[model samples]
Target: MIDGLKRPACALPVLLVGLAAVGTAWADGIPWADRLHAFGKASKLVCFLPLFVHFQNSSRTRLVFAAYLLSNLLLLLLSFVVFCSPDISILIGAKSPGVPLKNYLDQTQGFAFIAVICVALAIEAIRHQQRGQAIAFAAIAVAFFANLAFVNIARTAFIYLPVMLALVTIRSVRGWPSLAVLVAVCVLVVGAWGVSPNLQFKMARLLGEVDAYETNTMVIGGLETGGAERLEFWRKSVGAIRSAPIVGHGTGSTKELFANEAAGQTGIRAKIVDNPHNQTLAVAIQWGAIGCIVLYAMWGAHLLLFTEGLSRRKGSLLAWIGLLAVAQNIVSSLLNSHLFDFYQGWLYVIAVAIVGGQLQRRRDTDQS
Candidate 1:
C-alpha cells in the first residue's frame, strides 16, 4: 500500500509474500540468510510496485518496451556471431560456446518473449497496411526461432514458444483464421525439427535422460545431465512436501530436508539442491498447501487482469504484452522456478507491473 499498489488483486500477493517472509524468519533451523532467501526473492514485486504509477504514462511505457526489444536484438546479434565463429567468441572472452552471454535457459526464454513481441507487432503492422514493418518484424521473429533451433537451445523455450504462439494467435485472430495461423505455426515447428539436428538431439535426449533417471543408470563420470538432475530434485521434493504437507517444513528448511535425504546417497541422488526446479513444489516445500494457494491465486489474479475484458481492439497491445509475459512465466515455471531466480523473477515482476499499470490507466479512462 505504501508503494502505491492500489488494486487489492495486486496488493494481496505482495501482502502474502511479506507474511511468508515473516513466517520464514520465525521458522526454526537454517541460518537467517537461508530462511529469508526465497521470500527475499519474492519481495521484489513489492519493492518494484511503486513504479507501477510511472508506467501509467503510455509514452514512458512504450519507451521501456522499445528498449527491451533493442537490447534483446543486440544480444541476438552477439550470440549469432559467437555461435558461427569460435575464434571470435574466444577473442571476445565469451565463456560458453554458442551462448555468448547468460546460460542457455535465460537466453532462450528472453528470445521466446522477443518472438512473441515481434509476431504481435507484425500483426498490428499488417492490419495498418504497413507492409515493410510487417515483413521486418516477421523476419526478426523467424531469426530468433532459428537461433533456438540451430544454435544453443533450452528445452524450456520449446515449452514457452508454443504456448505463447497459441495465445498470440487466438487473441489476434478468430475462427478459421486462427486455425490457419496455428497450423502454420505447427508446420514451422515441424520444419525446424526436421532441419535442426540440435533440436532433434535435445528432444531425444530429454526422453533418454528421464528414462535414465527413472532406471538409475545414466550417471557418467560422477555427473548427471540437467534433465536427470531435475527429475531427482522433483522426486525428493515430493517426499519432503509429504513430510509436512499443511504448513510446510517452514521457510529455509528445503536445504536441510534435502541434505537429510541426500545423506549416504551417491551420484545424482547425493546432490542436495536448494531449488526443486518447479515453482509450485518450491512453494509447497517451504509453506505447504497454504503457500501454494497464495502462489496460484496471485498468478490467477494477474492472468485475469490481462485477459478478462480485453480483446483485439485499439490500444489492446499493452494487454497482449502483459498476457504473453504471464503466460511465458507460468509455462516455464513448470520446469524451473523462474520466480526464485534473480534475472527472470525481476523480468516477470517488471513486465507485469508496467503493463498492469498501463491497463489500469486505460480502464480508468474508459470509466471516466
Candidate 2:
C-alpha cells in the first residue's frame, strides 16, 4: 500500500509541470506557478551534475549520450544560422533587421541545458529499470495540453520533459484518479471566476463574426472590422499562391505580395501581414508545396521514432510522451510557426534521444 501511495508522488511533478504550461495566465497573480517555473528552470540547470555522476557509475549507453549531444549541437547550429546571417535576408529577399546571432545562440543554449537535464533523468530511469510506459504517456498528455493554440507552442516540447519523468515514476491507478479530481477542481474554480466563460464567449464571437462576414452578400454597417480584414488577407494569400503554383514568388516575398494584394481590395488597407494566419499557407507561400511536404516528412520521422518505442514496449513512457509532444506540435502547427522555436527544437532532440536510449537498452538486454 505504501508503494502504491508512492506512485502518485511521481505524478505530482508532472501534473505541476502541465499546470504550469497551461495555467500561465493564472500564474500572473499566483505565487506557486511563478515559483514552479523558477524551480523548474533552476532544476534543469543542476540536473546534469548528478546525472553525469550516475552515468559514470553505471557505465551505460555512452554512445547514445554522445548521439544526444551531437543532435543538440546540430540544433544549436541551425538556430545560429537562421538568426545570425545578415546574408540570409538577401538570400530570402525578405525585409526586417535579422535577429542578432548572439541572442539566437544564447536562446538555444538554454534549451541545450534543459536537454542535458532530461537526458540525465532518462538515464536514471534506465539504470533503475523503472516503468517507462507511464512516463511516456504523461509526457504526451502534458505536450497535448501545452500545445493548445493560446499557449506558447514552442515551449511546450521542452517544458514537459520533466513531466514525462514524473509519469514513469508513478506506480498506481490512484495517481490517475487524483489527477482527474485536480483537473475537475481547477475547471470548476476557473469557471466560477468567469475565465472559462469569457474565453469561450470571445472565441465563439470571433469565429461567428468571421463566418457571418464570409457568408454575407450585403455589407453590414458597423460590423467588427478585424474579421473582415483577416478574410481579405487570407483571400489575397490564396490568389498569390494560385499565381505562382510552382515555386513561390520566393521565400519572404509573401508579405510584400499580401500587402500589395490587400492594398487593391476596397475597405482594407492594412500593411502587408508578416505571416499568413495559417502555418501551412505561410510555408506553402515561402517554400512551396514541396517544402511543405518535406516539413511534414520531418515531423513524421519524429513520430515514427516515438511509435517505434511503443511497438517494442521498451520505453513506453518516453514513447508516449514523445508521441504526445509530436502530436501537439503537428496540431499546433496549423496555427503557429513552431518550427523555428529554440525550446521546441531542443525538446525534439531530447525526446528522440530518450527513445533511442530505450531501444539501445532493450537491445542490450536481449543480447544478455
Candidate 3:
C-alpha cells in the first residue's frame, strides 16, 4: 500500500513537468502547428481519464463530480434538441420575431463541458482535505478556461492542460528547484508577451478604440464617427442609465433605450447591441447600481475567500495557479459575456466552493 501510494506520488510531478514542457513548446510556436492542435484535441479524452480516476476514489468528490457531469449532460441534450428543431418565425402583435435559438444552443455546449470538468477537479481537491489544492485547481481552471473560451476552445484547452500539469508537478515534488523552474518559465512567458507584436497590437487597438469613443462624448461635434458605432451605442446606454439612476429601465432594455435616446440623432440609430462589450457597465445599465453592488459583493466575497485560503498555504504551487486563474477570469470578464451564462456562472461558483473547501480543510488540519 505504501509503495503504491509512493509510486503514483512520485510519478505525478514527472507527468506534470512533461505536460508543462509541451505547453511551453506550443507557446513558443512549435513545428507543425496544425498537427499539434489536432493531437492536443485528441489527447483530451485521455487526459480526462486520470482526472476521473482521481475524483472517483472519494465519495464526496465523486458526488460533486456526478452533479456537475449530469448538469453538463442535460445542457448538451438540450442544445442538441434545439439545434435539430426547425427555425420558426413567430409574430407577436405587430412586430415579427425571428428567433435563432439554435445559435445559443450550439454556443454553450463546449462551455458546459469545460465548466463541469473544472468544477469536478476543484471539488476533488476539497474532498482530499487539500484546501489550498482545491482553490488552486479551481482558480487555474477558471482563469485559463475563461481566457481560452474567450479566444478559441481548442487553443485554450491545449495551453491550459500543460500549465495544469506543471502545477501538479510542483505540488508533488515540494522542492525549491522545481519551483525555481516554474518561476523561470513564467518570466519567459511575461517577456514573450512584451515582445509579441501581434499581441501588443491587438491590446493597444482594443484599448485605444474604447478610449477614443469616451473622449468624443465631451465634444459638440457632428453625429457621425464612421466606424465608431459601438461607441455611439455606449453613449446612448450611458444616457439611459443617467435617466434612471436608482433602478435600470429594465432587463434587455438597452437596445430599446438606445433607439429612443438616438431617435433624433442623425446617422446614429439603434443597432442590435445585445450586450455591452463591457460586462460591469452592461450590468449597471440593465440592473442599476443595486444590481451592480450585489454582483460586486459576490465577486468580492469569492476573492476574499480565495485570498484567505492563499494566506494559509502560502507555499502551495496549486494556490499560485489558482491566483493566476482568478486574475485571468476577472480580466476576461471585462471583455467577454460568460459571467451570466448558466454553465459559466456555475463554473465560477464551483471554483469559489473549491477554494472555500480547501480553506476549511486547512483549518481542520491546523486544529487537529
Candidate 4:
C-alpha cells in the first residue's frame, strides 16, 4: 500500500490537496480570517481518511453494497412521489418538487448513476436466471429513468446518461443486440421528449439560454438567468487563467479573482462568483496548469484502474459501479465543479476506494 503511494498518478491528488491548504494559508491580499476559513475546510479532508481501509470481509461488503443501493432506491421512490404530488412536495418543504434532499443537479446525477446500476444488476440477474430479481431491478431502473425524464433533472444529466447507457449496452451485449439496445435507448429518449412537457421545457430553456448568452441578451424581464450568468463566469475564468497560466492566483483565490474581474463591470459581467462551475477552471484558478495535470491524471488513473477491475470476474459489478461514478464525474465536471462539492466528492472517493480495495484483494489472492 505504501509502495503504491509512491506512484505519480496515485500520489499527485494527495500532494495537490496539501499544496491547496498551504496556498490558502499563505495567499496574499486575502484577509487572514478568510484564509483561515479556507484552511479549515481543507483540513476536513480527514473525513475521507476512513476510505483508506479495505472492506475485506465479504459479508460486510455485501451489507455496505445493499445499503448503498437501497438508499438510492428509496430516494428515487420518494422523489417520484413528491414529483407527482404538489401538496406532499410542499409539505416536505422541498425547494425542488422532486428533490427531497440535496439540489436538483446532485439528485439527478445520482439518479442517473442509479438507473445505470439497476440496469446492470438486472442484466446480471437475468444471466443468473433469477427472473424475479431481474424484474424488480428492471422496474426500479424504469422508475429512475422516468423521474429523470418527467421530473426535474440537471442539464448535465442529459449529457452523461446517454454515454453511460452506451457503455452499459456495450458491456452487457454486443453485435446486433448492442445496436438494438442503442436504437431502443434513442427511441425512448425521443418518446420522452415528445410526451414529457417537463423534458421539452427544460431542453427548450437550455437552447434559449445558450442563444441569449451568445447574443449578449441575458437579462429577460429585468432579471438575469442562471444559464447566461454561468456562461459569463466561464468566460471570465478563462481570462483569469490566461493571465496566470502557471502557478495561478492561489488557493481560495477564485472569489478574489471574480471580485477583481467584476470590478468596474456591469450586468452579468459584473457578477462575482466563488465557483466558476467548471471543475478544470476551478482547479486551474487555484493551482494553474500543474493543478489541471494532476486533476486529469487522477481521473485517468482511476478510470483505467476500474476498467482493468472489470476483467476480475469475482466483483466486476463493483468495477462497473466505480467506472460509472468516475465517468459521470468527468462528464459532469465539464459543466459543474462536482469534484469540489461535498456530496459528489465523497461519492467519487468512496466508489474508487471501496472498489479499488476489493480488486486489490482479489489480485493478491490470485497471486498467492
| lDDT tens per residue, model 3, 106-143 | 23334434443464467657768899978875774564
lDDT of each: 0.81, 0.45, 0.45, 0.77
Give model 2's TM-score versus the native structure: 0.45
Clashes of each: 0, 8, 1, 0
Error of 4 at 194 (Å): 0.7
| Candidate 4 overall lDDT versus native | 0.77
> In candidate 3, residue 199 scores what lDDT?
39
> What would the per-residue lDDT of candidate 4 be over residues 153-201, giving only the tens digit for each residue?
8888878888888888988999998999899989979988999987997
Top candidate (lDDT): 1
lDDT of 3: 0.45
lDDT (10s digit) by residue, model 1, range 187-277: 9789889999889988887777877776665464443577888988899999988988988887777888889998998767888878999
TM-score of each: 0.93, 0.45, 0.44, 0.92
Instruction: Report the alpha-carbon TM-score of model 3 versus the true structure.
Output: 0.44
The better candidate by lDDT, 1 or 4, is 1
Error of 2 at 202 (Å): 4.1
* Cα error of candidate 3 at position 199, Å: 4.2
Model 4, residue pairs in steric clash: none
